[model samples]
Target chain A: MKRVAYPQMGNLGISVKSFLWELGAEPIEPSPISKRTMDLGVQNAPEFACLPLKVNLGNHLESIEKGAEYLLMAGGIGPCRFGYYGEVQREILQDLQKDAEMIVIEPNIFSIYWSFNYLHGGFVSPLRLYRILKFAMKKMKAIDDLERITQYLRPRAKKPQQVNLRYQKYLKLLDQAASEDRIKELKAEGIERLQELNNPEVKDVVHVGIVGEIYQVLEPYVSLNIEEKLGEMGVQVHRELFLSHWVMDHILKRVDRSSYINAATPYLGAMIGGHGQETVGQAVLYAREGLDGVIQLAPFTCMPEIVAESILPVVSEREQIPILSLFFDEHSGEAGVQTRIEAFVDLIKRRSERSVLA
Target chain B: MRGYLGIDVGSVSTNIVFTNEQMEVLDSLYIRTQGRPIDAVQRGMAQMYDKDGDLQILGVGTTGSGRHLIGAMVGADCIKNEITAHAVAASHLNPEVRTVLEIGGQDSKIILLRQGIVVDFAMNTVCAAGTGSFLDQQASRLGIPIEKFGELALQSQNPVRIAGRCSVFAESDMIHKQQMGHNTSDIIAGLCAALVRNYLNNVGKGKNIQEPVTFQGGVAANVGIRQAFEDALKVQVIVPEHYNVMGAIGCALLAREEVHNGEKSSKFKGFEMLDMEFQASSFECDGCPNHCEVINFKQNGKLIARWGARCPRWEVG
Candidate 1:
């Protein structure tokens, strides 16, 4: 087996690893993200960059350093920024003197031969590949479900330590479930273990709102499992941008405006450019909805989100919504990230205390 | 007489509309968001109060991305998406209208319809070059107020061609044309033409734009842009009288329809919500690889609603 490694999206490393392990292959860990890695990326890439590209660029460089034979990259061909990310990043990586087989998986209609060929080449036996995809989907769902249930329990736990114990127990079981050949057995055990976990209520916990790039928000490995650590500190976590909302906003409503524009109106008009509008809208929503504080995560040199970051201070000032912007590149230190989060939590707590005293 | 109130809160503006039992718009107010939606809403409500003395508000509906927050604040009976609200409003305005063109201060959208069903629509979220902001910037550069932009454009006998591909290109092209001795009226005309051109090339790309069309939002106020659009499409464009606050009007209509049908009591917090102090906060979850960032709500030091979590598994009563 040509065990290739690529820095996939956030939380993807572990999932890919588990998937690889199930395939009877040992997968190498993609190189960690670092400042130097991003610097190399920026040098090789275009001026207009999304956060995911910078992070992935650093990932590809790091993975090459780790002796990976091939780079696994997903391609999006759509109207969005994602469509051009793969090609741009690939050229950047190659220019920077990284030698690795770049496997670009293009997402397109079935008519696209490149997509068909890529899939056919990746898996030798069609039946086996079907089985693998099926298993991967189930495992992904289980892991997502497990994370969802445990995240809530940790915050509400009266005994913060108990929440950590339950969280760890569930995480282990989820990992085990992903690796299990008989997924049914793992599923049953996972559900039973989750139901049996003791959850206590933690009072006066700090609440923090997480908002940023879609991948950065969901992938635990990317954000360093920021949500779990917050729960361990007895902080309540509220994340903006749900998959459901994104789907409704992006997929469904995308066509909802078709009835409004015509020959007379001619142009379909332009978009609000960046998440600036959405961030402003969300910050106000958070303020009105009564969130304690907000943390915005964006990859270093991300244009759209940078616009949002600029306006967030105004949102914070006007709505009295405390918002912190965290820009991450491959070089972001775990300790530094944790310290900032800890301080933010402390700030919210002190603010809460002050509000009560007044 | 039973009535409904609708609130549409967008990034640049806040709109409030009132409708009678039959869902007919009685009055409305369009307030600049001015980066303070809460204050805008209060001011709008105060305006409504002044307009209609002792009109019983039976229900309230809120829409747009900020619908939930505003809905919660106003104790709304129904909270809906902008698409749904726009569709409802457009359908009511002209049942035969098959297409709706909404271009606001920051964003633009084209909604296609086949007999009142929203068959297809496209929204551009990543471009400002084709939006009203571009026009505002150009108006400033010309030392002309936005309100006077259309009038000046109408005076142009000859319109120059400015690059309509992007804001940067259009702006540089405009400055170059100005240096080349193009009259201000012609330049304004060229700017409007560029805006429409950019809109078509970018947002309206690959879409079939049909007729029975309605133009709306703040951008619709610019007659120069409307004429430019007409020149491009070679068709007559109809602008609704209440085009500026159609979203709010739509929500109010929806609310009226809901309440008249004996729906549950409106969730609107009432007029007193304008005075309440609310707090919001968020934290990260490191429990798993899915580092979910969650948000919560507090009113007067009491924890209220919490949202933004993928799994509602953490919510409490």
Candidate 2:
């Protein structure tokens, strides 16, 4: 079988893809998210569906039709719509009468044994899979490190072109290293290169925290590259949610109450019981850490974030922090976001000025 | 001599409540928004100013859907969500109260309180079967005024079951019972019962609804609905004194607290805000595919505030 694996972005997809590759399985390259993919997704998806669900479903469907037999994804159980997505996607594929096996790595609060067994069944030796995973994780960490380092340098780049060029070069190097045996060496070199590019001599700038849903947080096309736009405007960016943190918080830290409860006190109660709790905890931490402002981005129909958005005012009032909640659908625009960010930054600057006067 | 002004402009109605330095309700007005929040707010402000010309508005707190726009127009000291404003009002009135069942003109919300802190709450927005709008529509269709519908329901000897799963279902079911020759009182009481049942199933789902349960909002005035709720839940449903204007009262109380605590002078525009010309328009952001709807407010030909924006990209002048 000729295996053509798609480029994996985060922890879940990377883990699954690496495991499949280790088993001598062929994985077709998933299509890049484009207008055609989004249009197909919106047309097929249920009305009022969240953006992430539609996009991911569209990507999976496109890949499946391109002769990929195994379509892999994750599943959850909750009041949030995420828990039901896997089943809904399965039904949609079935309705389309696709022959691909929808491999769902079910995320349960209790065990990873089922996930391990499923992967092991495909592999001849579990130890070989373990070795592959070990290498994959190191590569993942390196990629994460390189991205974080770039965030620091990107804002201080004298011109927009400089930042864009540096980021593009680093991203290409990281992607090439993902499936290679010399992943560690490539990652280390990339990190060192990125670190060397950023210097403390660059002009100090105001930092803003971006917190919200996974899709809007990561997708530049959706958020209008608000981070890059902000950086171009001479503002440093601090994104609160990252793949590493999400893995640690949702996967490892969630294993026991003693592990995450103290650190995430507000989230300990009833899970809050979705991303609402997560968003609130992050907002509070962002404020307490003395970030200038926080921009919470979410889809328009999202329930958990809406609940968080409602209570965020009280948090803002108490902490004397300014948080802006931005909801995105297909209609969200760049100019609108720019206008709001400018106002927020202006507010922060003026507030600081008043404080200095006092 | 300074007074606090609290304005709650909901989708259906606009309310303005006034209080003295001591947080006493001095004057209040409730008017239907009638698809025009700007006009309703101006009219409400005009009435308040006319009623109390000499009152110096030291502070203003605005709440509800149009709070952001109205607050900016009036130079409000605080702009809060209806949930926070309502909770504050409920807590101030009866600090010991545990739950708030607020059924307004268009929506119904159940707020669960644990020692004055809101622990859990649910709002019924998708379905309007149990909201006051559904009830009003049914009453009007039956050729009975909403005010008398509750009274007519109270006279029913035996209540029938009206399917209140959805407003359309409830209306059809009500008509079916009426065609079967059920008395008007029975049909009206049946609606009251059906709405209570629907609310309990949806909004009160998985909730340990304890007392003292305070029912406030426009719908609280309906005695039949209260009786139906009481009979269904087997608990006493307490209605606050100012049921129709709790949101306004809460906002006023919040304003009073903000003014009393903050050292800076209030941002309130005094009574002259009643005559100010304000307009609001929204446009889609074209910078990205996200296309955020940015609502901008213009006062006297100058944009004062731009809200409903998700990102700060456009905030720069």
Candidate 3:
């Protein structure tokens, strides 16, 4: 079996590991992102590359050090810089003299066939491949659902840490579950456990929507655990970007993108690539839903998000919802991010209180 | 003689203010942090105690970058970010204030307010250009007292143009102009103009800078920068009486609100903390691959707080 490795993006690692395992490849899990990873990434990545690419490079380097022979990554075809991450990272690895093969699964009309054939030998039956993919999809959906439940329960829980603990516990159990029925059971059990943590006394929690680039919104390490921080501050976060949502919309072609595109028509008429259009669309949707505020997170120097950030203020004005745009980079300090979030929460809370009294 | 205490421990200065029930400032202190926030807070407290020992502190509030650390140390009733603190202070001082342009030691911000409520705000991210520290460096490099930097700029007959997009380029531009034998005042005036241009383009970008604008923060003390803002906005800028200590005043106002909002008593640890020793230390936790730097804050050789761990393993209240 060939040793395969992939970068981490929140809980997507579990599904990817399972998929690789099903293909009869030994999946090498890169160590969880740390300070050293960031340092290594910053040293090697191009000076102007976005944070996700740098972090991804660090993951590849770490995995290579662990003797992984194959690196699996998704390819893109858009104006956004993400489309070239695979090629650029491959060159960087080759320059470093690392012995590894880059396998980029590009999204195209025949992506399904090409990816399957490349990842699996002809010996594996098509029925088995279908089963493996379906199981992985189920796991992804289950993880996303649990995450959504955790966000809802976090602010309402008497002890937010308990919800986090249970969420982590269930994630581990779901990762270990072999059967689809067990995964479904574990997800249901996790929701029930999380629901029990709600505090009756806690009410009038602030609601904020998170709309941003997919990597920053999904990966806690890259975005600095913003969802958890907001939740701890008694704000219920509504995140629009999820791994399962992206896969369904972009890969499976099951979810429709017209609603978001139409909503973004006023602010962003065309897709500027990446999740920019979706970000603007979701802010509008969240505003219509009467969410008190919305936060847009993006990596510094990201073209798509920069476009979205510029237009979000107009949406915030027209929709009467406050929006804060935070751009992350290698130098982003925890204290600065914390201060901004605290002030934003305070601003929305005060606005809501005043409206209620009036 | 009862009042609230507010402390703003910033990168450059530690400001302390005492406000009466009516939110009027009774006394204030501005001292250099000198790279030691705890010592600065302690010194400020000692000075405040010596002057107003009989006066009772009803509540204590903290703000600025070092707010959390100082809040924990002083047992603050309320701790708020500098943005909220500045906005609250500006609005309270001038209820009709619509915009606030605050340039502090290390960071600068533009806050838009509507009907005394903060509607929008933007802070400088990943860049420290056009801030007070930059102006300070330039002033010293030109061999002029920072206190007289503004006065010198006003004397310029023709201000030279200096690049203001980045501090590195700005410094090189200043040096080139200086070596060319241009008048020092013209160079100083040009530097002020450049800084203001940078501020408006960077920190105040895309925001409405309506009238009734108030400029506060330590940088407001520079008449040159204030003049540059007036020139750029073509409107009079109001500098509040307590401009430098506005952040402290805001949290003091907030602390009063907090105390009045059904809180029985303040959590103030009192001025006696001035005599006690507080130690903060941190170490990398290798329990996981994340290698989170867990910080331990000790007060008088006893552990009071631990944080910075990604997981809740090391966190303590």
Candidate 4:
């Protein structure tokens, strides 16, 4: 079996490993992103490339060093720079003289079919392929469901660390589950274990919606574990960009994008590519839902998010919800981000108190 | 007399302030951090203690970049970010303050307040082009005292236009203007204008900067930048009396609030910490691939705190 590897994106490696294994390839799990990975990525990538691309390059380089023969990447078609990430990474890899084949799975049906056939050597029958795909999809959904539950319980829990630990433990168990029924059982058991930590006395938990580029929002390493930080600060975080949500909208074509698009119409009338429209739309939705505040995270020099960032203040004003926009780069420091978040929480809390008095 | 202590350990300066029960600043001190925050904070505390050793400290608060470290060291009753600290100080000084433009050593921020509540705020991200440190560098490069740089700008008849997008480009642009036979005062005035333009365009972007604006921070001492702001915003900018120590004053006020709201006693470790030997060290944890740098803080050969690890394995409370 050919050794296949993919970049790390949050818990995406779990489902991707399952998918690759089902396709009869040896899945090479690249090590989790670390400081060395960032260093290697920054040393090689173009000076102006977005952070995700640099980190992805580092993942690919590390995987190549592990003797992986094939690299799997997703391709896109949009005005956002993400669409060209694959091509740029491929060129960077070739320049480094790395012996690996780049297999890009585009958003089109034909590309998916071709990639699957190539990876599996056309030996896996259609029925078996369908079963494999369904199993992977189920795992993705299971992971996302557990994540949502964790977010819900994090702020309400007596010890938020307990919820975090339980979630991590369950993620490991779910990754090892072979059967669909086992996955379902594990997810239910995990949720029950996490629910036990929730404290009934915890009230008025601050709710903040996170809207941003998909990679930064989904990947903990890239975004600096912002959700966990907020959760520890006694704030419940909500985000629309889950890996399963991406799969549902792009791969399965099941999501109804109209509501978000309509909500974004006033601020961003057209899709400026990437998750920019989705970000604006979700902020509006969160505002309408009376969330305490909104946080927009974007990579420095990101075009789509820049457009969204510029327009978000208007939405913030019209909707009467405070929004904080944070831009991340390779040099982004943890202290600065922490300070901004602390101040933002304080601002919203004071605002809410004034309104109550009024 | 009973008082509250606030300490702001910023990149360029460390400020300590003592406030009375009515939130009035009784005494304040501003000292250079000089790239050593702990030492600077310790020195500032020693000086404040020397002058007001008899004042009973009811509560202790900390703000600025080194707030956590200092807060932990002093056993602060309340710790807050510089934004909230500055906003609180501004609003307390004048209840009608609608906007606050604060430019410190390495960070610049704009906070918008509505009815004494902070409605919106933005801080300079990934850039330090127009902050105090940059201005200090330019002043020294021109062989002029930073204290007199603003006065020189006021003497210019026709200010040249300087690019303010980046510090390197702005410096080069200033040199080019100087080589073209422009007066030093004109170049200084142009630099002030450029810094103000950059501040308004970057940190103050997409926000309604209303009148009753109050500018405070170490940089607020520059009359040239204040005049430039007045010209750009078309409103008289009020610089509070204790502009440089506003953050410390704010945290002192917050400390009072925190103490009054339910805390029976302050957690202050007391002023003797100035003489105690405090040490901080860090090492990379290789337990996982993340290799997080875990920091250990010690005082008098006793472990006080351990943090900075991504995982809780290395964290000590």
Candidate 5:
């Protein structure tokens, strides 16, 4: 197995590509998740599978057809059914007799290093491999930092489209940036450009926080670009979920989340896997920050999200902050999603206006 | 004569309602969209214009799947979703109403309200097995008029069991029941019961449905489905007089509030807009792999509105 491919999620694919290259294997680009890919996934997957699994299956098949020899996927271990996805996908692929080797890497602090030692296997020096890993992390960090700027400026930019343009440009620039200084300089320049386009502050702007499953929160395709929609509707959206952040928090365990744990205790006593606790924690944090509303997006039948959904009403009622829970699947309609979002925005706007009068 | 105007364009029907400042209904009309929303909107507005002359519109609102498209066409002040619209209309009709069971042409939704505010809501878009279109298709297939479907269903003492998880499954099951010598009325009632079951399991799943539930939408016009709902919940389901056009009524109420809140002049372009020549055109933009089908609207050959593009490249200035 020479060339490896993984399912694309936001800009994580680029980072993974760099990782595979350093591992002495070429990385084939998984095709972008589109209607065709989703259709292919749905055709091969079980009818009731969640959206991400179907997309991942489609990505694997697309890469295999493109001559990818190895498939690198992550493993989940929790109450969430995502833990069984890898085994199920491998079984499905084996049943089809696809000409590819599947490798499921458990994403953990030690497992990541172990996977590194296993995939490399004396091809590259340990020192060089460590350097490659560090550079990839820097690349991911750059991507997340630039996205944070977009989330801040998109709602305030005089030409909102310009912020999107700059954000896209930064994605490409980050890919080419080899050294840490170049990435930092690019990040600084990107923030400066977005700041220049931002319009004067408008008071009483509805502030919303987005929290839910990681992919649904980060992948614009799944959530239907909800952050952008909220931005265009004159609502400032705060999203704390990022792929790079996940790496540091979940794998490295470096980021301090005592605040999240403390806030989630009243609603969720413990983590129920699949970011369920984090979702509730984030909602509470948003409420404390005086956000007007919070929107939770998840795939249909997501176990962890289902738990979060059940507990969100209590958080909403007690915190006096409104929450809108949106679930999507292959059959989810964009128009329906848009209608609910627009109504939710209007509801918050009206509620805030009434409060202001009182 | 200062009234608000509301428009609701769904997959199967286009409805418009006119309401006075107090949110009381004045005139309303329901027309089949027939796969062309623009023509339906224009025709409905033209009929409204022909009936009520010298009626000044204070504000306009649009709802349903095509809210944005029609809101732009009608110069609407507030464009809301069917959930909020249904909740508003239901609450207006029954102040203590806590649940709204809306089954439209191709979609169904369960909205939970508390203290006249929308507390939670769920919509079933992918599954059309329990929607108005499903009933319409089955009615046509069984050689029964849709208007009489409910009346026939009410006559059945023993409703046969039909799978209502998906439209295809339900159709096949209906055929099997028919092949087994099931009466037409029993089969119809069975389908109605199945739809109610599917709805409660899917759209209303995990939703705390409280009493004083108001069932509205095109499907609510069917007395059989209404009774099935009553039997399922064991609570009398109230079907408002304007159940079929509640979305439009809610939109009008929203428009009235929007206009009153800002205390600004109405943005309505006036009835003269109906006389203007407006055209809509769509084209696929191959700038990327997505090839989004961007839509644009022109009035008298001037591009006035454009959307549906993922990037700025396909945007019409």
Candidate 6:
């Protein structure tokens, strides 16, 4: 039995672990993404690659060191450059002579044949593969649900860290859950615990919508935990990205595309790839909802987000809402970034206070 | 007798400005940071108040990367980013100012204004090629005082081409040009042009820079860069009399505005507080992957403020 490993992005660990278990492979879990991983990634990666690619590369090498042979990766097509990450990373590892096989799951709808073939070598029964996939989908939904609860409770909890602690507790509980009903029960228990954790101190807080590139928006480390920072400042953060929602709409093709496409049409007419259109859509959505402001966080030199940033000012102007665009890189100063965020929060707060009088 | 105090604690310099109710530059001090922001601020304060400390301060404002630290040290009323502070100062100094080109020691910024309100702004990211420190390094390398470097560049009849895309490349190109027997003045002139092109391409990209453009920050001391900007934009770039300390002046104006806007009293920690022990220190929190360097500020033995951490986990009341 070969062991497969993959990088952690939010709740992918639980989802992938279940699928790999059902597929008859011993899934060696990648260690939690941390400072060591980032350092290793930075040392190994090309200087200009987007932050996610570098960190993911670090995850693979660290996994390989821990005796995991084959690596599992997902690909995205078009201008994202994420599609090429798998092959590029493979070449880099090969050049290092690490002797690891990379199994890429094509991001195209229902394009699981290649990965399944690799997993079974045409020996596994179709029924078993179907069951494994179904289990993975259920786990993904469950993991994403837990995350939604965390996001909802984080800012509202008087003790902001209580939400994070409950999140960790639920994550482990869901990971150990045995059956479908058990998983549902654990989710309910998690929700109840989170409610208990929620503090009643939240009041008249500034509501901010965060929208940007998928990786920067979803991964806390990549964007430097911006949502959490805003929450600590007593701001109600309304993040526009959810792993389950993204997987369902993009991978499962279960949702209508027009819902976002129509909203983004006025500002951004074409799909510019790498969540550019989605960013514009979310910004417009939050603006219309009369949220305090919107924050667009993208990696430096991100082509799609640069385009989105260009159009965001118009959305902000039309909606009469403030917008702050923060482009992150490794060298970004923590204090400088904080100053901008504080100033932005103040700008919106002062603007609202003035409007009440007007 | 009554005035507002603004303190700008930057990476390269700490500046203090005092502005009376009439918006006049009462007294200003600019001193090198030498990597100690707290000490630099103290030195600026000492210099500013030396033998002429009779002005009654109404409010205090702080701006720059170290705004929070200095704000807490002095109990400031308003703490603002350099972008807003620069824009505020430029608009007040030149009411018709449409754009601001601020190239500080470690970074640069372009702030756009309309009808005295900041509409758009951009700051340099990880590149110091077009900043004051880089120019200062080049000046030292050519054995010219930074104050005299611009005057020497003015004498260059034919400027040599130097790559200012990156600081390393620019330095190497300068050396290569030097080895090729290019005049030092010509090389310096070329360097100024290179930086201007880089600033326009990177920091000022896609922004509509209209007249009257105000050139400020420590780099404004260099006439070569100012002329280069003027030549490129085909318009006069105005460098005000107090260009270098504009961030401080702007914060002073803002503090004055806050005072007039029905704020109760100034939070200005008296200048005599400079005699007290105020310090700042940083330590990396190994709590998680981010490894944030939390900065702690103290006045005497008691903690005044803490900053630079992403979370409030280490914060103490």
lDDT of 2 by residue, B1-317 (tens): 56788899887889888887777788888899898988898888887767667877778899887787788888988877677678778978899988899888776877766567555555663567788888888888989988888889899999998988988988888889989999999999999999999998877765678989999998988999999989988889999888889999888877877777445679987666666778888998776434667888888778888865444555626
* Model 5, runs deviating above 4 Å: A21-25, A64-67, A78-99, A108-123, A255-271, B52-55, B93-96, B156-191, B234-236, B258-277, B288-291, B313-316
Candidate lDDT (C-alpha), each: 0.68, 0.72, 0.90, 0.91, 0.85, 0.82
Positional deviation of residue B22's Cα in model 5 after best superposition, in angstroms:
4.5
Writing each residue's lDDT as its tens digit, candidate 4 over B1-317 gives: 78899999999899999888888888899999998888998888788778767778899999999998888899999999999999999999999999999999999999999999999999999779999999999999999999999999999899999999999999999999999999999999999999999999999988799989999999999999999999999999999999999999999989989989325599998878888988899898887566778888999989999878755686565
lDDT, candidate 6, A1-358, per-residue tens: 7778988776778878877777778788887777788788888878888877788988998999999989988787868887888888898899888988988778763567657657654566767777777777776777777777666777787777667767776888878775788888887888888888677766677888888887788777767677777777778778757777777777778878786788899989999889899888888888888888888988887889999988887887777777788888766666667767876776566566666876
Q: For candidate 3, write residues A1-358 as lDDT tens digits.
A: 7888898889999999888888888899988988778898999999899998899999999999998998988789988899899999999999999999998877764766666666665556677878998999999999999999999988998767678878988988988888899998999998898899988889889999999998888888888888888988999999878899888888888898888888899899998898889999999999998899999999999999999988998898899999999999888998999999998998898887788788
- What is the model-wide C-alpha lDDT for candidate 2? 0.72
Residue-wise C-alpha lDDT for candidate 3, range B198-272, written one tens digit per residue: 999988888889989999999999998899999999999999999999999999988988888325599998778
Encode model 5's per-residue lDDT on B164-221: one tens digit a residue.
8998999999999999999999999999999999999988877788989899999999
Q: Write the per-residue lDDT of candidate 1 for residues A257-284, one digit (tens) a residue.
A: 3322221021113333434345555556
Best by DockQ: 4
lDDT per residue (tens digit) for residues B1-317 in model 6: 77788889898989988887787998888888898888888887777777576767888999998788788888888888887888889988888999999999898988877666676677776678889998888888878899998888888899999999999999999999999999899999999999999999988876779999999999999898888898899998999999999999989888888777325688787877878998777899987655777878778878878876655587767
Candidate 3's C-alpha runs over 4 A off are B261-263, B286-290, B310-312, B315-317
| lDDT, candidate 2, A1-358, per-residue tens | 4333332233334444554565566657566566666787787889698877777677777887787766666666667787677678778879988776666655653334454445445424556645765665665566567666667777665554365555556555655555555666776776666565554667647778877777678766556667776776667778756766665667656333343334346533445445666677677777888987877888778887877777776666666577777787765654446545654664465456556676
Which residue pairs come into collision in candidate 5? none
Relative to the unseen true structure, what is the C-alpha lDDT of residue B234 in candidate 4, on a scale of 0 to 100?
97
Docking class of 6: acceptable
Q: After superposing candidate 2 on the true structure, give the runs of residues whose Cα lies further than 4 Å from its correct spot.
A: A1-55, A58-358, B261-263, B288-290
Question: Which window of ten consecutive residues has the lowest lDDT sum in model 3 chain A?
Answer: A115-124
Q: Model 3: what is its DockQ?
A: 0.62
RMSD of each: 15.9, 10.1, 1.5, 1.3, 3.3, 3.7
Q: Cα lDDT for residue B37, model 2?
A: 87
**lDDT at residue B61 of model 5 (Cα atoms):** 89
The iRMS of the candidates, in order, is 19.0, 11.7, 1.7, 1.7, 2.5, 3.6
